[model samples]
Target: MTMKESERGDGGPGNGRPDTGADERPAEPAGLRGLAALLRPRVSRGQLAGGVLCLLLGFAVVAQVESTGRDTTFATARQDELVGILSDLGQRSERLRGDLRELEETRAELERDAEGETALEEARERAATYGLLAGTVPAEGPGIEMVVGDPGGGVKAINLLDALEELRDAGAEVVQVNNVRAGVDTYFLDGPGGILADGEPLTAPYRFLAIGDPHTMTTALNIPGGLVKTLQGAGASVLINPRAKVTVGAIRSP
Candidate 1:
């Protein structure tokens, strides 16, 4: 073969085939070689571990700095705005506390007023009952009727007063003599023509109406040595009648 054919039979530099040589071997990939160099154990195990810890500490310091920077943004905000927010919260809390206290006071006051009203009502009821018993008010119930006929005008004021005492002792709630109210403080005086009770003149044949239990009043008057016997000894005709219902429609002057 000629020299040109011999050169052609050998692969040219531009050909896809690799050059063969006894001193050359296949080259490793660049990325794989770099990875192998990094993984190669060149230091002690303790030294490697210390290097990784330092790297993690650096990353943590960087994160802390970023977080502190964000917090400083709020700290550098307007002083007036921060003060106003805190003041508003404090005032709202105080107002709520004041409202709660006022409600409690109102409830306590209402309870006290209710108790006072009940006590006042009870006192009024007691006053009314006493007024009725004292002959200051008109009364009506079963009682005894007495007719005293003093034909000789011999019924003295003392005798009338004694009879009133006897009737009161017999549970007489109210008494009327000749349509005149005989109260606890009533006075009887001897007049020229007849007897005067509470400044009102009374004629003869005095009619006494008392409000009480009829049986009790009758038994009290009919007892031996009672006011009836005394009045008969004074030459006054006395008659007592038990009535199922008797009314003393006279009220003492206020």
Candidate 2:
């Protein structure tokens, strides 16, 4: 009734026991072993270096993208502000230009007014000078005063005319005889009583007021054979006085 050993599965040769003959198999070659180790996945110095470089490159690319995005956002946000600033500056510049133009125009207008005033003042001065020289205006300055009295009635109208000519030749700017203006158009005539100037009879002790250099007028009349000598030669008494101030108050009749 007992089973044979072949029927006992636990003691059989191909049963669940490791094969002892595996150790007796031939050893693999050194080159094959090295090649198999290389083919196997493992961490080495060269592989580690390559993996680190790849990680750094990925991180740099991500950072570059993020930075570029941030810059673009900031630029877009400031675009309106920049445009407004430029617009305001342009407007201010235009206003300044306008103000400058107005100021320049004002300056030019002032210059024109000043020039006109200067021209007007010059014309007034010229008119005043002409009026003074023409005996139309009353003049007062340092000059000579002469008194000629013809007591004997021998003094004629020609003697008065010669005295006027001498006074004019001595640079007399203005002359008045017996309160009458002795201008270029003045005339001397022989009246019934005495000499007449401008048709007005002049009384004795005829006064001659001349506006000029006192020394020049005095020297001119006192020269030998001059107006003073000629008047004295006649019955008229001549007296020349050099005065500090003499006024020719007679104005020419209009």
**lDDT per residue (tens digit) for residues 124-155 in model 2:** 99998888876788889999899999888888
Each prediction's whole-model lDDT (CA): 0.87, 0.88
Q: Report the lDDT tens digits of candidate 1 across residue range 1-254.
A: 88766666657665445777788978999999999999997999999999999999999999999999998874877999889878999999999999999999999999999999999999998887887767677778899899999998878888899888888999988899997898878889998867899889988798999888878877888789988888888889998899989988888777
Q: Provide the clashing-pair count of each candidate structure.
A: 0, 0
Off by over 4 Å in 2: 1-79
Global lDDT for candidate 1? 0.87
Tell me each candidate's TM-score.
0.53, 0.65
Largest TM-score belongs to which candidate?
A: 2
- Native-referenced Cα lDDT, model 2: 0.88
